[model samples]
Structure formats: structure tokens, C-alpha cells
Target: MSEFKQLYKPLLDGANWQQPDQLGIEGTEIGHWLLEQDSLSRRFQRHCEAFTVSLIEQVKISHAALTNDERALIGDEDCLLRKVVLQGDGQPWVFARTLIPISTLTGQERDLEQLGEMPLGFRVFTDRSGRRDALVVADVGTDTQPLWARRSRLWINEKPLLVAELFLAQAPIYGKEKQC
Candidate 1:
């Protein structure tokens, strides 16, 4: 259990996820910010004239096993866990992480492993299986104020990949000035 905990430490899986339309968010502007339509990567591009995807970490951990939810979507496969920050006009905005199985990277998505600093959604939206669905949205933070986040599965040829996007605490949508 401790090993599982440590492996998923970088993720914010502490709270339960809610559906946007079903969730009764009255006074929370943050909730609305996270419920934006279309792919987040595309939204960032449209909103910000100069958007960037900055890779933070990409590693292979043999000791780490997938969570039950992840395993269901990704299957019993070795994955490349990659994390990145979405910056808008040089301002830190959203933090995104993806768990991509090695098998998925070798097929139609052969180019995915080489995305480097490019947005993950670029490859995600290319093929017919790029549509994102079965989303889980939540708000997480150790402090009193929590940031909004969403997760979903991206499928290609029936193979699944998990993608999570978190609206950072310092993100402009919360309180700061315009990002673009």
C-alpha cells in the first residue's frame, strides 16, 4: 500500500470526481473554468496567442503499478508517465499528466513517444480514436482552497490511455490577470 501511495504521490487522486452538468456549482467560478468545451490544449491555443507545452518529467518505473481505474483503462501494460505544464504567453497555467502504454506508442500512435515538448493533445486528436470521454472531474489541494481538475481516457484501436489536466493554483483563471 505504501508503494502504491508513493507511486501516485504526484497525482491528486484524494477526492471524488463529479460530472460538470450534474454538479451544482453556484458560486464557484473555478468549477466553470474547468468545464470548458473542446480539448484543453486547443482551448489554450485559442485563448493564448503564445501557448507552450513544457515537459517536466517523463520516466519509466518498474516498481510502480497502475491504479485500479488506470489498469481498467490502460490494461496490464507498461506505460510511459509524462507530466507537463501548459503555459500561456509565458505564464504558468495548467498542469497535465498522461499515462501511455508502450503498446499504444508503437501502433497508429507511433509518433506519440516523440512528441517531446509538443502538446499531447496534438497526437491525441490526430486519429479517429482521439476523442476523449468518460471524464472524472475534481477539486484538489492540501490547503483550504482547491484547484479544479479533470481526467479522461483516450482510446486508439481499443487501446486506452489516461490523461489528467489540473488547473494550477497560480493559474490566471482563478484570480490573476489575463493569460494572453
Candidate 2:
């Protein structure tokens, strides 16, 4: 178990996730990021002068530790939990967490386990057969400083992986204007 997982999983579990429309973010930029079907990494690349993916940790998570929604999608199987920070122009913009069921890492999909420092969108989006479902949005962090987030299940060739992205306070989107 990683210290990062220990610290953040609770916050993720505590989130009250709902659809973007349910939260009244429909016409906003934050809503755009949460609801858009495009590759978020590609969007950031277009908006920022420089972009990078920083891996924080990748570790196996026991089936017992998964949230109910996670278990429903991944079938209570042990999975790899990958955490990374997406940076734009040297500033931390998004914190991303992914849960990959061990069973899904077979055949060509095994490459997912070795994507060190590569944006996940680079791999997941390249496959034409991939699709997403259960997109939900939430506000995490403390009451005084809330962070926007979105969670969804990405299906590639019928295999499932859960992905969640939290927009950090320093993210370019939270600036005076939507910078990125």
C-alpha cells in the first residue's frame, strides 16, 4: 500500500458523486472537462506550452479495498491502482487515479502496466474500440477549498478500467479565466 493511496482513497470514497447536470455545472468550463468525450491530455496539450505526466505510484490494491462501485465494474478482483499527476507548464493541474483489474492486463493490454510517464489517454484513446460509461462528477477536498473531479469507466475491447481525475486548486482552469 502506498502512502498516497492511504491518504487519498478516503477522500475519494467520501465524495458525493453525481451527474454534471445534477450539480449545475452544465455550461461551465469545469463542466466541459468533466463531460467532454475528447482526450483530456490532448486538450491540455493544446492549451499549455508544455505538458507532462508524472507518476506518483502504481501498486496492487486488494479486492477488499475497492469501493462498491469499483467492485461492481471490476468484479471484486485484485487490481493495479495507478496514481499520477498531470502537469501543464510546470504546474500541477490534475491528479488522476486509475484502477486496472489484473485480469484485464493480458495480450496487448499488458502494455498498460508499463506506461511509465506516458499519459494514459495516449494509450486508452488510441484504440478505436474503446468507449466510456458512468461518467459522474463531484467536488472533493475541504469545504473551504473544494476541488472538482470526474470519474468514469473506460472500456477497451470489452475490458474495464476505472479512471478518476481531480482538478487541483492550482489547475489552470481555476484561474481568473479558464487558462487551460
Candidate 3:
């Protein structure tokens, strides 16, 4: 177990990223990172003027069973899955996977049909009517030691879309690890 997992897994994995003000959770290193309000693109740009979003994989995949909160908003349906790494000065900082349900695609939201290398935050943050839902934060992987991750639900034109963004363990804040 990582020093952090021993220190915060009970606090992080079980956390409802929405209520960040909860006791015993404040003043955490990872907590501050996840609490940033700036668009991810802008944040990366600040880190390096030559920041880039490298497309890792994007595909339309069969939807898997979702959690209760997710199913309540966007019904279970095949979704467009986009995975990308946000790089700062050629170094990867974040691994982001955005899942846009086919059922939620309607009207202008359909513009996501071809995202290419654009940051999903660009599409969601720019919408005047769009609103970000409470983030669901966790660090869930095979190791289960805990890493930083945040899930956001953006409502554009009343259409709900789910996006999950993970802060790579090597992302400099928690202490950089080998890039590979």
C-alpha cells in the first residue's frame, strides 16, 4: 500500500467528491488537486505553454451496467468512449475517459459525433447553459492502493453526460513516478 492509501483510502475511495468540506478530508494534497475549478485544458496550458491532448483511444462501445446514480440520469445505452492523456511539456499529467451516451445525443449535443483531439472540457465548459454536477472521486485500479480520480456530470440542454478524469500518479503533485 502506498503511504497515501494508508493515509487516505478510507477518506478518498469512500468519498462523495461533492461534499468536499467534510471533516478529516480537508487540507489533503489530492483533495486540493481535485477541487480545481479551471477547465482542464487551461490548467495544463498553465503548466506548459506547449500543452497537448494526445488521443489514446476513442470508440463507441457497448454500455456496461452503471451505478445507481448514473443509471438514474442517463439510461444504460451504448456510449462513445474517449480516452486521452493530457500532456504538459510532452509529459503526461492526466488520463481522461469521457463517456457520452448515445441516448443523450440530441440536437446540438450531437456535435460530439467527431471530437478528434479536442478536450471534452472545451465542449462542456463553453456551454452557457451547461452545469457540472457533483464530482464522484475515487482511486480504483487493480492495485487498489489509491490514485486521484474525479467523475463529473455535465448537463447541456438538460442532457446529462458523464466524464471521468484521473490524475496520473506520476503527475508531479504526489511525487512523480517513471513515465512508463
User: Among these predicted structures, which one has the highest lDDT?
Assistant: 2
Query: Per-residue CA lDDT of candidate 1, range 39-67, in tens?
Result: 67776676678889878788764415777
lDDT of each: 0.71, 0.83, 0.66
CA lDDT, candidate 2, residue 69 = 84
**Cα-lDDT of candidate 2:** 0.83
Residue lDDT tens for model 3, 39-125:
767655655657778776777877674556666656688788777777777776777767788866778998876777788778877
The residue-level lDDT of candidate 2 at 64 comes to 94
Q: Candidate 2 lDDT, tens digit per residue, 1-180?
A: 255456665666777889878999888877777786757888788777889998999999899989788898668899999998899888878878999999889988999999989998878889996778889988987789878888988888888999988887887666544444
TM-score ranking of the models: 2, 1, 3
Measured over all alpha carbons after superposition, the RMSD of each candidate to the real structure, in angstroms, is 4.7, 2.4, 6.8
Candidate 3 TM-score over all chains jointly: 0.73
Model 2 TM-score, 2 decimals: 0.89
Which candidate, 2 or 3, has the higher TM-score?
2
Worst 10 residues of 1 by lDDT: 1-10
The runs of at least 3 residues in candidate 3 whose Cα sits more than 4 Å from the true structure, single-residue gaps closed, are 1-29, 65-69, 140-146, 175-180
Q: Relative to the unseen true structure, what is the C-alpha lDDT of residue 114 in candidate 1, on a scale of 0 to 100?
A: 81
